[model samples]
Target: MKRTILVLSLAFCSLAATAADTSKGAESTAPTCPVTGKAANPAITLVYEGNSYAFADETAKQKFSDDRANSLYQKLGGKTAIDAAVELFYVKVLADKRVNHFFEDINMNKQKRKQKEFLSAALGGPIPYAGKDLRSAHESLGGLNDSHFDAIAENLLATLTELKVDPQLIEQAMAIVGSTRDAVLNRPAKPATPAVP
Candidate 1:
């Protein structure tokens, strides 16, 4: 679940701007609307549960407000479920021949804590992530590739399945993880191809 949420949350963050400027009178830094991925109007805002959300318009603001009750974080049983999933995931990862080498000499206690924090925030938990960006963290691993990522993702899916999480949710979560592939692999993004005239 943590893996799923982390991927989804990161995907959401990569696609949408959850942090739009909400200052009372100042001009915004062109914050993108989480609902529309368009520049948000600082004046159009909603302060839900202490997090101020800026919107492109009233409709966007309303959508964000309504969606809060069903955030991925809450749906994945929040912190408790995330914690359990991360713990189980590490066990699988550590046991897997494909990815175990990545953690052989690392401090697991700290790694698990970071993973929990990262996945929690990625899944929309209240706390923001305070760790190394994915690229930098994995760039030093020399030969990291898609196959390794696939292995880790496979383990995550297996863990979630064993935990009996809903299949639909797992699919959603996997899509999110899939979006992080390039970043996790530290690869340069493919340039957008031009549209046919």
Candidate 2:
């Protein structure tokens, strides 16, 4: 009789352990955003909570766009501010003798359009980018060295400051840009040259 009782107790313990494990897995896979308290779409929920490369949801996306525009407008003192910042960025780039050559043949109008679209998209606005892929565009630049990339980054920060954009918004925008560093700087290795006979 005592042996049978012990067997039943062991069985109950096993069932309890299995139930606990199932609950844990479900909790880990749950799709709620800790930030906005909204249920994330199953497809994108994993992105927000999973790896670093995940895209933002619609709410996060809109927040980014609105924050950028507001920051730029306030930082630069309104529409006039954004215009001045843009002008300053180009002027600084053109003055850099080493890298200026890269932009010598560029179409300013088209470049401006792309910049606007890129900024809008980064901020989570409705604009869909129509520009060339970033890697393809920079591939022929023969690899942007660290200094060259730093110079551009500095100029952008300066422009943001001159426009009087909020510090937090500027930081957020910079972080977004930083995420692309690897793709921008590290090109795929060139194919091995054929061996000479």
Candidate 3:
């Protein structure tokens, strides 16, 4: 538990230090709208949730502004924030006994990079995720159950909390992550059985 806290503290400080250095003069660095896949016009930038985001045009900008759940990637802080959160999230996961064994033979460096990509794209970032779909990725990890899933979710929430993420944003994140639960657990799709005639 102490280790978890220590890891999160260091990660939070690291992100803070980095943000302090770049945030002073930072403009909206995103060059395209994640939703529209179109060139972002800097003049059309919208400052949503205190973060400025550039959109391809007024339509894309409006879409982003109108949707809170879809704009979480930016609302929570965009690429830099996602990277830091993933780092701390992994630290918590590795320390937790509940889900650590599943990662024993995995390459953490690659895993972290993939996770960042997956989450960035999942949270509506412009980049498309290139990794295997969730079912293929976790299908080999036999016996994964809701408990393991819960532990991972718990660690993620902890990471977000330690980083002082807004509760509302955390709720959005959890919902997005939860949407992947069935696939992550390798559950087969249960097609609706035809009702007895």
Candidate closest to the true structure, highest TM-score: 3
Q: Which RMSD does model 3 reach against the true structure?
A: 7.1
Query: Residue by residue across 21-138, what tens digits does model 1's lDDT show?
Result: 2335433334878788898898987654335667899998777655654567656666666777788899999999999999999999999999989887776764579899999888
Count of residue pairs whose backbone atoms collide, per candidate? 0, 6, 0
Tell me how far the alpha carbon of residue 20 in candidate 3 is from the true structure, in angstroms, after superposition. Answer: 19
Provide the lDDT at 100 for model 2: 80
In order, what lDDT does every prediction score?
0.73, 0.51, 0.74
The TM-scores, one per candidate, come to 0.65, 0.52, 0.67
Model 3: pairs clashing at backbone N, Cα or C within 3 Å: none
Candidate whose lDDT is highest:
3
How many backbone overlaps does candidate 2 show? Answer: 6
Q: Rank the candidates by lDDT, best first.
A: 3, 1, 2
Score residue 72 of candidate 2 by CA lDDT. Answer: 28
